[model samples]
Target: MGNAIGMVEFTSIARGIETSDYMIKAANVELLKSSTVCPGKYIVLIGGTTGDVKVSMSVGEKYGGEYLVDTLMIPNIHSQLIPAICLTNQVENPGAVGVLEFYSIASAITAGDVAAKAANITLIEIKIGYSIGGKGVVVLTGDVGAVLTAVEAAKKQCELLLQTTVIPKPSPKLYETLL
Candidate 1:
């Protein structure tokens, strides 16, 4: 099976933590993030082979029960997606930048993968509702044309999209502030 990533968001931190433990123990997958986000919601992210990710996701969802807020699973996900999610992407001297805002972390992550696959762009960040009122944010950088094209593609695939923008020539300080 191809590589994949999964996420489960919960309204209750206790359930989220329990589910994360089950998810990792259920399959040979890597636990990427397991923590509380803005608005007191918790999220668990994992990655592995497609089949393993699927198995682990099922365990998480089953354990998540009534506390589940949202879920995401991407098979053969874009290489940049994980780094962006972890806020470790290093994009320097960006020619242009694009931003996608969504109401859920899942939507933002899905759109980030879509945008990365659609154009020659580097995903700058995938801020998962941290200090942002439970809204997701995706940022990518590339040439003006690529950034525009990628943003359009991401927007088309995104659900609960709040806003989107492409800055052709962003200020140097703008890039620094994103981190």
Candidate 2:
């Protein structure tokens, strides 16, 4: 058993829904999220052991077919990733905060994982494209140097409109808002 994660994005909701169903049935992976996102796109997230996740993703990709937009598979996903994606992370004493924004949920998730693995930071949140016009947002907290390093590492993975900011000694209200 391992913490592996995978995702598939689709332009057609019908195909996405069908693909998600097939994905779960094809493997022992747990369905994380499967629903329509912003701008009329559909996204499905799944997690399990590395082998199971890989199998599920393969089925999802095959069934996704023409409607597939993008896909991601992380063999060893970070511990904070699921919480961040599900908005269940709790904040602690923070020194600096970093924000990374992307045009796609898959990009944001990929970058978020990179950032988390690159530095000793706490991923505050990884808001997917449920709202905010299909944009993905990642929030993290750590020392100024770590936050900066994490943000920079994450920036390299994005292929679209990306906005990033690092706030040193962020206001408490900012953390509150993020949580």
The estimated TM-scores of all candidates read 0.96, 0.95
- Write the residue-wise lDDT of candidate 1 on 1-179 in tens digits: 24799999999998898889999999999999999999999999999999999999999989999999999999989889999988888886577989999999999999999999999999999999899999999999999989999999988888999999888888879867975
What do the candidate models score in CA lDDT, each in turn?
0.91, 0.89
Q: Which candidate number has the best TM-score?
A: 1
**Candidate 1, run of 10 with poorest lDDT:** 170-179
- Which residue pairs collide, candidate 2? none
TM-score of 1: 0.96
- Residue-level lDDT tens digits of model 2 in 77-105: 88899999998877776779999989888
